[model samples]
Target: MAFGRRRFLAVLSTTAAVLGLASPSAERAAAATVCPLALSVSAQVSPPGGSPYTVCSGVVPSFDGTPLDVDVSLPQDSSGPLPLMVMLNGWGHDKTDFESTTPAGNGANTYHWNNAWFTGKGFAVLNFTSRGFHRSCGKDPATGYTYATDPACAGRADWTHLADRRWEVHDTQFLAGLLVDAGVAAPDKVVTTGDSYGGGQSWLLALSQDKVMTPDGTSVPWTSPKGVPLHLAAAVPQYAWTDLAQALIDNGRGSDGLSGAPGDGPHEDPVGVAKESYLDGLYALGTEYGQYAADDPTADIPGWHARITAGEPYGKDPLINQIVRQLADYRSPYDMPVPPASVRIPVLSIQGTTDPLFPAVHTAQMVNRLQAAAPGYPVWTFYGDLGHSYADNPHQVWAAANDEANDWLDAVLAGSQPTTARTTLSTTACMPGQTNATLTADRFSRLANGSWTFTGSTGAVTTSSIPDGTEAAAVDPIANSGCRTTPAQSDRGVASWVFDPPSPGIITGSPVVHVTATPQGADAELAARLFDIDPASGTQTLITRSVYRVTGSPGNVQPLAFELWPAGWQLQSGHRLRLELTQSDAPTWRPDNETSSLTLSPPVLTVPVRTS
Candidate 1:
């Protein structure tokens, strides 16, 4: 399946009968004029029956003149034109992530993306490898090097654009055009969705304008050959980041400036530093796996290498580092100060309650912004298990979250209005088959609060190795039954508090934690955790957690405001709520260098309690 310039030219030449050909004979009559596409009927079968679909795999020219590998799935059983679905893969992954093929090459699910399910629901799914990833034509073919390693690819690597309006966003419009021209997808009626990297791209696609200036200072056409604008009928971004910089750094400001703060601020001019472990992974994806480092014979190549270096500790320069962070925020969905009224498409955002990577509060922030832009907009949010894993768990309901999303998409396709309900699927509060459960927030001012302070010696220090793998220790929040014996209360450099409710209470939203800590070192890191403790046995079950970091004066008591992972949990009558403040969690965040006696003020944990 090697497609070069000649192959792309062949596809372009065979485009005549693709649009409005009407009949098979007409298609054949014009076949000589239309370049034939390299398409095949995949063995993949649809669910609920054995319906089949055709897969067109090849390279399509993207907005930046780079060719991207694309997989177009069309149901052979379709009676007429179908709505288009463009799926974006997560970071460092290609179109293969959505495929059902296992590592051993056995096809377990038949279709990687459950394409058969969507095709059965009458959708044409376009799965394409984003530029600069997995066989995409961004690297230098002669040396097989990527932008990560080879300076030659600097001008064309798709990741260099990093979901920029001119690159990936523009490429989506171009791909949709190709589908439309081929008569496989309907124009002006496409739904875009994906998880993580792909999920974030969906928001960029919806918010982007129809004009773009390429990185090389050239203006490109953002429309199809027929001049049709890219029309996104709806979008469903799962676990996506609304603001990339904020998601990375523990900055006090929330997505909409109305959300929440990193520190309980009253202090002036504070900055949120980068999370090293996660940033390291993100940067490595471009250099190590993205491009062949071995192929580049140079020592300490620039670009990503230099950026990674700059990202290390207090960063390059205080002013410059802050500027870079601000730039990232401006480039993301946060740029949309007001949701465009033109984008009336229903948005169904799916988030993970226990995901440390991209916290659940981001979903609420997005929902608030979208609804604020258009009052009564059909925007919905569903909270499920942690991260991208689909493993079964007792704490979260992945099955129900998926079902609700499908139902919303089906309704939108049928011309129904978007659902206004915001739901969270939790086995504790709203069990499966239960009805009439509403979500509410338990305010901080409403809860009885107490303070616990643990002071470390002036020389006491904690550190962990870079690129920590401890995050995978507990994939599911409830997967680790042994957490009861973990003993978080008395750990070194940790402060603990306990809450015992007389009656059982259900938490339905993001939990806020306020900490006023006296800093001892040049920089500081604070992590907050909520634990469900058994009053009698003293066993602790971790509920959720959040991390915050800041750089400033060491003597002042810094007021930090942050939220734990948005979660829905039922605190049984005898169960006690424990709040623990820890100095560091290796692999999760970079350790603070300075050793200081930290004093914690009365820490308050405010959870959203469902009422009625």
Candidate 2:
């Protein structure tokens, strides 16, 4: 039932085995051994029950000689040869995991939705699993998580490196070429898409200019698992990260509107928050020169990049830090080292507003670079108020149209016109009782607050367990890192909003807080936190928290301001919705230091709820 290069794995192996080609002396010796495996391809049914798709699975070469299992799904009813696509997964994940979760629910993979939307109109999808993260076999011999997790082998990682995006870009190019060789797909029509790690891979594939070197000595090139030049056509990454190095640096200390809470008071441990606080500077570079050379060692201000030179920093870093530098350069379809003066294909992208990993600056910078390289690349950005996760976010909005986001792929990739809206929405907090049982059990608890009091299925879902080390890093507002812990004053002095326990379980998404303050022009800060607001110990232990800042400047007269961000967690049955309004958050935002005293009114942070 499968078509495309993925099928070639089966066809070639079968032919080889049938002809006794397993080994030159197999027939003259013992016996040819073939591993028994089940590989099948399927599709989404529309209008309650639509056409079934044909798909196939097989173990193929990943970034290395070691094989990776892939499931290539295609439309059975297409009238012509199909377009090609390679889908990837994120961190601590595998291929099947991608198939199970997405921005869209219903067990339909969002990437799969791309397949459905495009395949039904005539496109082909090849889902790839890299070496270590998922079921994909093999290993990353070089940098990134691999090096840190296995440092002794750090410098040795060459073609096997999965930390940099080139390894993945090669994975897509090789897989696409194989599909073309099989005659099931057109090599030139292949496109790539993914989220988080996958999404970052998407951009890496798109901007991959060539096999370049870095000052740090990391390696990247269009090579086979054996080091060969690979190719591609288009790409789309969602909620991705770029300039993570800069992010680590700037997030260390915040500036003006941008802040990264490193840790708590001077005595606080920098362990979890240290390197990450520098994202502000990283994002600043992304905002200012994301399209340029922030990571390039040759750049004037190599620490962070902004504007113009940001359009493409291809060759600059190849001579210095190869690992960190190589992480910056990726080869696109054009076979060039930069995004190219133009792209032969259109590109589409999505980003979450409250994504904890990367900044919105990355998305904005990407569009600028794409436009500079090629006019009308046909880009799309979807905003969500969630952190790095794709599965569940308390801030997720239930959009009837968001469910149909794949239609864009259908229209552009397979040539189908899907009628769906592509806009951002706020999470809708669940009411006291209803059918869609707001409580999503597993993913419900780990958010703004460290944990929530729950009932019913106490242990039905594992993700519902508490995340250790949950405390806001203390911030020195003066030093300008806006990240901080919830002050006792904020609990009693600031305006507070509360909700009662629900009879039925509940799940909350991103929150939108609206606050009214007296004495206009106040620097109002709204923080949506999930805590035992009425703490049994009298002191509320802070959990995961979301904070935002706004300068009230409406006609020099401040009205109620609405600040939206992700609660990105769940509100268990007994947990209540807590919204606090105050002058500042320690390190994440600027403190309101105005002489005018501000009072909080109508301070309620709305929770997003979806019921059955």
Candidate 3:
């Protein structure tokens, strides 16, 4: 069943039909190659169930000589050379994790595990275990260092440092060399796509320059066997964090509910305040799978652990905290040091608006920084109401995100898309259980703005086993219950504002919320929720929510800014838009320390109402 150029082109037509691409025109049909460059492949043939693909597995030496386990799947019926796609796994996961359904039941993924979907479209996929995970090899030299021992050495080679350019990025560069030297992939036609950590790695590979700096301050040339600069065509990073510190701590909000305020918190216990249960799980995964060394039990996981235990006044009191912060700054992809303009790669960034692990703000911030550096880089985005994994949210949302990703890959590889230009965002939105009601936008306009004042509570609620955080109305709105009795607002430390629109419209894009308030105490924690209220029944359906921490002089009024998670929700005539303000939401946020009254002024919710 070997496919020549003609056969490969024919197969593409079938794939196009399935993917809803343009009808295969005569020009495309006569085309012999799917990729702009020819592929060079070396693999072992495996034919299962009468279908065939070339598979190969082996250990490749990383830049620092660490052994990396890599698996490659090549098209069995290729007419000529092929394009290469490298897929990386998330934290603590080996390459095989992508081959099956995620434990969280995100989307039943075919792209990660089965090569057929990609191979059928004429791509060679290379999946590799990151160094220090699974069968890969790397030693955390810091594992043996302690505060009583060598403090500087203890911070080196920590788990969080796993993604440092000197390590993971080097490993990727080394693997690219192997593929090119083996003549299985074109040096310039390679693209990387990964989820979470894997997604971050893809960005690292695509954005990194031809030179990498080692820990000892040594510069090494990152080049192919032929000594050419390592050139990666494009990247797609889904649910990936650009700033590790922001991802783990700081939370873009300071201690005492203020953003950019000094110190982690009054006590400096970031783990407890910033989602303890969730972060602890991540720590456990990294420790169990980090495998710093098979022989050593005392290798420090990473500098964060040491800093976390040290607590507040993070950078000053404990010198180690300062060291770890420097380490994080070194590895950070966004922020100071590395100019955003330097990491310009055409990117299709996919993020979950409802994700608890790596909140939607992370992607929004990353995009803003990237745009700031390179004003018009070709960056496209798809923000779905998804959680950490696709399955963490609703199935319908995953379908939309997954399908759009496929279309992006096809268009980019075909040269129909540009990599450096203003980001052209996709307009696709999804809602679960809606068969007839579509998620589309007509026109966008700002509904007139107003604000309200509410009391901020110092009282904290007990945590629930169910882990219900900020429930977004776009994803968790009451069903046909809108047809039943009206839902009442929670009387517990909450404020509400109701709006009646002149006409029916869809809420599209990110909605901006502005609040002017003075905290009765030193600081206050706030959560905002948007609801679509049924006029007849007064039933309220939650559409989206956002949380913020405000800090300032106890009695001084300051303006606070935050956005409700982006939504593409439908609104009908006579429906009321209600904005709910609350002081505390257990599990999602730590309740404020004091019973602070918030002297709030009129808050404005400017929704992007689709008018057409």
Candidate 4:
């Protein structure tokens, strides 16, 4: 299996050669023509019956005169007059992050083929990079490149190359337009979807048909694609940053939750908005051209210390330093807020359970804004275990999520009337037959062959019991009875179960503890939290949340089972993952009894494992 270097660089340089298509003006002439993508397609099946399909690369003209590379894939069928789904990539990225193009040899992006099922279900899938990304013709000789000084980055228009701004948006809008231009899809009814940054764009396209405000707050097109629409027929946006201002706020360094100094008030001022560290680095590099050697200076750049601590050698680059500070002040929600009432189309919003950026909370914020603005309309939301883009991003969910979003869109695009349920979760959909992935209390995560761990509990413990082949050094959280010993305790609410780290490199799914307190009596619920020893502080980053709330009861010997969300935390090198148990996660979740001493048996912690 060779890495895709030719397709990457080839498309990066020459587009017409790869996609076998003409330039923009030429495309316009061919637009109304019915040259509906003369292409071949196929599929590759994963073990146990999971099949993904793909298509050869296609072409279009994105950007002003630059060539844009297109990767279109479909299901394993030659369905006719298929519904189309055209998607674009995010910053510093291309179509690969979404889906692969080919399974064997050097092929196209998969998202094209990944959507084959969607295509099989009757839809044509499309994904591509703008002229700036590989094979997409546009290139900014300044900021994006290491040796170029991007002067454009220093003004009101945001110094991104025209490729970044116009070309990318053009990439998506153009694809959808091409279908109609070439008579592939009807303009009025399109079901578009994406997660994270791409989700932002899908919302943009659904709205692209709407006549609304431009990025500059000026009103534009209502349907014919002017500066992106403010509407769509059915749009699914998952784990997306609701507002740019909130994104900068959530992305601010440190978990203190201050967004900015309290004086930073509203996000009306872009310059005074926000600034992340990288933004500053770009400025410094741009200001001090020919002064240093580096690729992109990300946060982990080792050379930063050598340059910064080496005295004020780079002191004259304060303007460069202000780049980060400037970015922090940005408040462009919906990429550029158009008022949710402005968004009259059906919307399906999904969120990730543990996405650090563009978190579930951000999605909630969007719902709040939209509901307040437009009281009666269709909106569906889902929170799942997946993260950002399924394939293309370092932090996005690609496959598991794409299907989830697509499944819902399938219902909407089919014109199913939705109930007025403000929030609809996906627990019932694809709910794998609940598998009991249990491990003895002494072990970290569950492994095959009944090997929970090498230790077990010595007495009455709440974690897991000292079962066969359990750890010898298993910890007992029951002994840790006081709140003072718990950093997360508020009024006697904290539970801890300790275990050894699994053989290094083993990442475990969320842990579910099935415990039975012989006597069940509680008004409060049990909040399950996953924590690990904080190497330095010797505590834990207690990832706590509610499992279920049980009404305080007065009974004897009742079975109680709590399923904590399957988590993905590592019992890292030199550290162990701990399960903190509590009647409730305080302040946020209040436990009724502080002194309810009940014997806990069946002390089993069920952990999901990538590699047992």
Using lDDT, give the best candidate's number.
1
Error of 1 at 236 (Å): 0.6
Put down candidate 2 lDDT per residue, 1-612, tens digits, no spaces: 000001112232343355343344433222222111234322222311233344466666533443555767656445334677677765434454333212232232242344334444466677766543323432322222332343332332222233344445555666665666555666456677766667776776666543433324365654433343445555666566654432222222111111121211111111012122333333342222112222333332344222212321222343323333333444212122335443334455555443444544455444544444665445555443322422223322324223434455556555443233322333222222212222222121121222123222111111101111213234221222112224332323334445565532223333333444444443333443444332332333222344433344532433442323232222344444444444333344323333334544444444444333
Candidate 3 structure lDDT: 0.51
The TM-scores, one per candidate, come to 0.74, 0.48, 0.68, 0.48
Task: For candidate 4, write residues 406-496 as lDDT tens digits.
Answer: 5556666677765323343221111112121222221112222222332225354432211222111122211121111233222222345
Ranking by lDDT: 1, 3, 4, 2
| Candidate 3: segments with Cα more than 4 A from true spot | 1-51, 77-82, 100-114, 137-162, 217-221, 250-273, 292-328, 336-343, 387-407, 414-488, 496-503, 520-523, 532-542, 572-578, 591-597
Candidate 1: regions farther than 4 A off? 1-50, 77-80, 100-113, 138-155, 158-160, 209-222, 255-269, 285-288, 292-331, 388-396, 427-485, 535-538, 550-554, 595-597
Best by TM-score: 1
Over 1-612, each residue of candidate 3 has an lDDT whose tens digit, in order, gives 000000111222233234443224422432432321132222222222223344455666555555566767666546433677777777766665443211122243332224444555577777777766655643223344122232322323423345666667666777776667666677677777777777766656655654555655465666666675556767877777666555554333321111221222211223222343345556666665554432221224454554453333332445545544543544555543422554355677766544545545556556655555666655666665543522133455555555666776677777776332222222223222222233321111122122222232333222111223343222322121111122745443456677776776666545556668777654555666777777566467566665555666776878865566555556776776777676655434444444566766667666665556
- Report the CA-based lDDT of candidate 2 relative to the real structure: 0.39
Displacement of the residue 578 alpha carbon in candidate 1, Å: 1.6
